[model samples]
Target chain A: MPTITVDGRRLEVPEGSTLLQALDELGLLMNGVDVPHYCWHPKLSVDGSCRLCQVEIEGVPKLQIACDTPVADGMVVHTTSERVQRAREGVMELLLVNHPLDCPICDQAGECKLQDYAVDYGLDHARTREPRRPGRKRVELGPTIVFDEERCILCRRCVRFCREVPETGELVVENRGDRSRITTFPGTPLDNPYSMNVADVCPVGALTTRDFRFKVRVWDLDEVPGLCTGCSKGCNVHVGVARGAVQRYTPRRNDQVNETWICDEGRLSYREIGAPDRITRPAVRDAEGRMQPVSIARAIERAAERIRAAVLREGPAVVAALASPHATNEDLTELRRLLDGIGTATSGAAVVEGEPDGLLLQAERAGNARGARDLGFGDPGLVFEKIRGGGVRVLLVMGRDLLAEPFLGGTDPLASLDAVILLDTHRSALEQVADVVIPGRMLAEKGGSMTNHAGLVQRVPAALEPAFDAHAEGAVLARLRAALELVLPARSEGAA
Target chain B: MVSTLVAQAPEATVLSDELRAAIDREIARFPEPRGALLAALRLVQDELGCIAPPTARAVAEIFGLHPAEVLEVLSFYNLFHTEPQGRHEVRVCTNLACSLRGARTLLRELEEHLGIRAGQTTPDGRVTLGHEECLGACGYAPMLRIGDRYHEELDGPAARALVDGLP
Candidate 1:
């Protein structure tokens, strides 16, 4: 351990720690002193190119870049000294010399590092009367990314990220000096699986995601920590909401799952959260054989009544529950409780399994398949055969859209049921045939825990209200259980 | 419900056989294929006069590196050109010592004589005039390099003669 004094506060940091890391450990980043930086990311290799993290050290002849200087025993570093501030200001001046002043029209204006540092470390006005360098604007780096050359300070964070993290070196610095800019090799644009992450790591408005370029400003959007339900990988994410709409989904840093990155699939998967076709209210078929929106209480009462009548007439074996693996553990557990009370067999929860890409994407496309299986939703292969054989009467389908899935192999198996109760968030083709529908919440509109494929149970919080007065799956299930006078068994302590 | 579309894989046979063989030989000499990048690029540039974006991509595939990495290395150096160069290259020194000794006047004369400014090649692709910081011959003052050889102590007429004599 090396004992160091930053400003006037003394602290002991581990050996081999850089002065930047030591300051970070001392909580001095946002407290009293701030070291401005561009190329020095906590997850990336230190390039020491930005020259913005310079600090004065006692007994040292010159100021040193805190990111590259290793902590030495008895070292005294001053991050807020007048000399250090002047050197930092000088670096800030040079960085802004060629950088475009279009923050008002830039997408990353509110969250830009250059804008943040300019408030404290920047010179009030430019000293030179020379014109700013004009550059190629809105260059499509790939399908999902746009590059603005004039805004780039050449931090190389995106370059290092491509080489070191995803290891797809598609992006490169082309040319030299002032003419230098980031570009992809001819015919091979930055089309990697993790290419959008470049926009997230860019400190300025140089790189921006095409989907979110002019959608909403960062400050106007509300960032809510959430989990990606794209697959069993459960990559941690932040839900960006504005005006009761999902603007974007950015990866939240979680070292155990996705470390500062969510795959392109997960990142762009936020499009379906508040889609136009989302199921917003409870509906049931009227006497004219057409489905019409109804009250939640009436829909739940009719569903329970139909299920009870089917059980009494055809026996419990004819009424099967087909829940989805996409349901949260709490939702699934409540679903199992209701099914047990009715004395019927469950078709079991299973989702379409895709091959894992060996990165963050999992083979199981279901977000909570592990939790559903842990809640005793076993193999549904046998139940599907029984349903196709016309032995089942009343079927309650939870999140999965059977008519949409090719799993039934061109056969409309759910069509044979006399009464079908579909509880889902999105409107699928099956809604045309189902007898009753309950508008359930999407994962983004619910607060529950899900077990990943690795058996890691993580909390998924509600970022926004349910669409069209849709209730959370848990709340909906709990209400249905209450209507049926079914009591859930108490969960044991520390149980999954 | 977002779609996951995978990018098409780069073609397997983008490089010429001779270039591939040369890159393979360079790779065999180094412990890691990446260690041969600079040498392989240099060899390609020497044969083609410049490395285009497609050529850089082919070289990157050969070395199992990102074309961006190859481009980063290629762009950092002034010697490497990404476009076609003139048949005969001329570099005029313009460092502090050379500039103080009227190197700027010599460059202006050469530009007027060739009818093309610095960084531009002659219309017929016979010669290219470029200004470099220093050719490591600052003592020579107003000097120029023709291809790889340096010509020191050159007046405006002498430099014009050197360009005029180029075949």
Candidate 2:
């Protein structure tokens, strides 16, 4: 470690750390200097073309770009110095000279680094009489990215990103001077599994995602730390919410998992948030075979009464629960207690097989398959077969509609069951057929910890309030346990 | 204001035996494979007449680099044409010394004779003409380069003779 003094504060940074990283570590990087960077993404290789991170080192002859300058022992650096400020102003002035000034229509207006730095360092108006440089706008660089050349500052952040990460190298700086723009390979779409990360690496308004470009303004979003539940990788994410729905999911920096990057598959999974088929209210089948909406309390009480009657008639062997591999640890634990309380140890989470992508995506698609395994659950496929063989008469489903699986799809898996209790976030094929369908909160509307396939537990906070009359799956399970114990005098609370 | 790239990818190209051997020789000279990219690309351009996307892919395959990486280098330099190079390349200097000595007029005359403008290939595909900023023969004002040879101390007639002299 080398000791360096930045802006009058002395601190020891790790050896081989750059001045910018050292300043960032010391917390001395602030004030009118603003962000003072464009091309230096923490994850990508540094291309110091922006020249805005200029700092006045005491021994250096010229203002050195902080991102490219290595820190030395006893080196004194000044980031808020007059020379550094003037350099930043000059850089900002030159950067804005050829800008289209279309911030009003730009999707990156609010959160753009160019916009942020321009506020503190830019001139009131352009000084040059020459017209703004003519460059192409709305260039579809690839299937996922839209390129606006004029907005680019020749920073090469996105170019470096494609070259380094994903190792695709699809994007390149075409031409030279003012005509330079990010161009893809002669003919290839930017559909690499992680191509959307380029838009996240771009600090300016140049590259914007086709999916989120005009859908929602960034400032309107309420960010909550969450995880991508598409797989057991548990890549941490910032769940962007607006109008009570998930607007987008951007990668959150979790070095243990996804390092400031998420796969395009997980990024676009936000589109499934408020699908039309989502279950909004709990429903119970009427005598006429129609699913009629019922109060949540009434639905739970009716569910308990039906289960008690089945337990008293067919004994505990007639009942088995199908647990969700996607549920949180708290919910899985509660589900375990509920299944045990009923004296039926028969349970299994349905297992689906797929090859792992060797990146953030894992072989296990469920977010908490490891949690389910650790909490003591079995194969849900076996539970369905048991129901078909007349061993189990009643089935309680957590989220997966195992009865709808192909093996049981032809014949009604619910035919042998006297009652079916389904708690699901989305409407399924078995919804109308199930005896009771309880509306459950979506993963984005529930808060708990989930252990990934690697057993790394991460907190998944609710970004939006539970939609309609839904409850957290854990809350429903706890209430169901309370309801079941009321009749089973032999089974007291916490006795299971 | 919408744009999109094709979902389909361009096919990769295979390198010729001699070009592959030359590329290996170039790669051996440098510590890293990428260091030989420029030399390898020039060799490919020489062999294939131009470093088009296919040839670029071929060179990239040899250098273990992305095709776009090779294409970017080709795009940055004015000499590495991406299109099939004409049988002959005619370049007239349009720098300060050359332009002052009637180089622009000579270039226009040549364009008219060749039936094409600077930076364009003739319809017959016999010659490609362009103006350079400097050809490094400033003493011979308004000097023009034809292939590897420089035609210097020239006027309209001699320049025409030199251009017509292309076999």
Candidate 3:
């Protein structure tokens, strides 16, 4: 272990650790003691080209880059000295020489590091009156990202990320000196699954997400901790919500899961959560056999009445419930308890399978399929057979649509059921045939815990209220359980 | 407002057998195949006059490396040219020491004699003129390196005579 003092506070770090790592271990990086930097990402390799992490050592005459300099025993460092401050201000001036002042319309303005440091380091005004060199304004790098050449400071964080982490090596720094810019080869576009992560790593407003461009500003939105429901990988993310709708999903740091990088599919999957075609209110079958909007209390009463009548006519074996792997553990647990109370414990979970890219994505597209299995849900293959064989007359669908899967051969299973009750956030193919449709909250609006494929339990909090009159699956299930107790007092008493 | 440099198509292979064998021999000298990229690129440029995008792509494919990585290395160093080369390339030293010794005047004289700017080649495809920061030849002040040979202590008339003498 080597002991080094940062501004008179001494600490010991593991041998061969750089000074930047020591500052991070001492909790002086990006908080408490601020060292301005652009190219020094903890997850990426050391690129000392930015020259912003310069710090003055006790004995060394020149300022050393804290990212590349290894800590020595009995070394004294001063990061806030007058010399260090002057060096950082000089570097900031050079970086801003070619960078544009389009912060008002730039999507990364609010959360951009260069904007924050410009205000922090007192370089908010330009010293040179020379006209800034102009370059390309908006270059579509790929399907997910857009590149702005004029606003780039050329820190090369995105280039390093492609070459180091994902190792795709598609992005490169072309031209030399003042004409240098980040670009891909002519034919090879930046089409990797992890390409959008470059937007997150950019310190300036150079690279921005195409989906989130001009949608909403970061200051107006509230970032709430959430998980991406795209797959069983359970990548941690921050849901940016504004005005009761989700705007975007950005990755959060979780070394055990995604490690500060999320796939482009997971980031864009929030579109389904805030899509305009979502089922916003509960609906029930009316006199003309059309689904009409109804109050929550009325919808639950009608569903309970039909379920109890089916149980009385054909035994509990005819009534079955199908749970979705997308639901949280608490939601699935409540659904299982309700089905057991009604004497139809033949319920299983729905699983969607695809090819895993061997990176962040998993083959099982459901977020909580493992959670469903842990709660003793039956296999999806067996449940599909029970529905097709007509063994189940009355069915409760929780957060899944059976008609959406191609294994059913384009057949609508809800057409054969006597009464079909559905609980989903989005409008599905089975909506026309369902006897009762109840709008439920998506993953961004849920307040519960979900177990990932590795059995790691993480909390997913509600960022905003449900889109319309919708409620969480757990909340709706609890309300339905209360409504059923009144209709079937004898069966409820035995289960209780 | 977007601009991109055209990379050569990966499907094209423009290297001859002799050049490919030379590249393979250089690559076999190092434990890591990528360590011989500079030498392999030099071999291609020496035989083909310049390392075009297609030639770089072929070399990258032979070494099992990404073409972009090879292009990055090609564009980074000033020694390697990624475009078609002139029959004769002239680089004039223009650092502080050489400039003080009247190297800039010599460069201007050579550009005027060749009927082209510093970075442009002649219309007759005879000579290309370029200015370099330093060639580590301060002892040989007012120096110009033509094709691999350096001419020292040159005046305006001498610099013109040197370019006019090139066939």
Best by DockQ: 1
- Candidate 2: where are CA atoms >4 Å away? A23-35, A378-385, A401-414, A492-496, B1-10
> By summed lDDT, which 10 consecutive residues of candidate 1 chain B come out lowest?
B1-10
Point to the candidate with the largest lDDT: 3
Cα lDDT of model 3 by residue, A193-299, tens digit: 78899999998889998889998989999999999989998999999999778899999988789888898989999888878888988889998998889998889
Clash tally for model 2: 1
List lDDT for all candidates, in order: 0.83, 0.81, 0.84
Best by TM-score: 2
True contacts kept of each: 0.49, 0.45, 0.35
TM-score of chain A of each: 0.92, 0.93, 0.94
**TM-score of structure candidate 2:** 0.93
Q: Give candidate 1's TM-score.
A: 0.91
- Which residue pairs of candidate 3 clash? none
Off by over 4 Å in 3: A1-3, A10-12, A25-28, A56-62, A72-75, A124-134, A404-407, A489-496, B1-9, B96-114, B136-143, B152-161
Rank candidates, DockQ, best first: 1, 2, 3
Q: Which portions of model 1 miss their true places by more than 4 Å?
A: A1-15, A22-33, A72-75, A401-406, A486-496, B1-33
**C-alpha DockQ for predicted model 1:** 0.41
Residue A272 lDDT in candidate 3: 88
The CAPRI classification for model 1 reads as acceptable
Model 1 scores what on Cα lDDT? 0.83
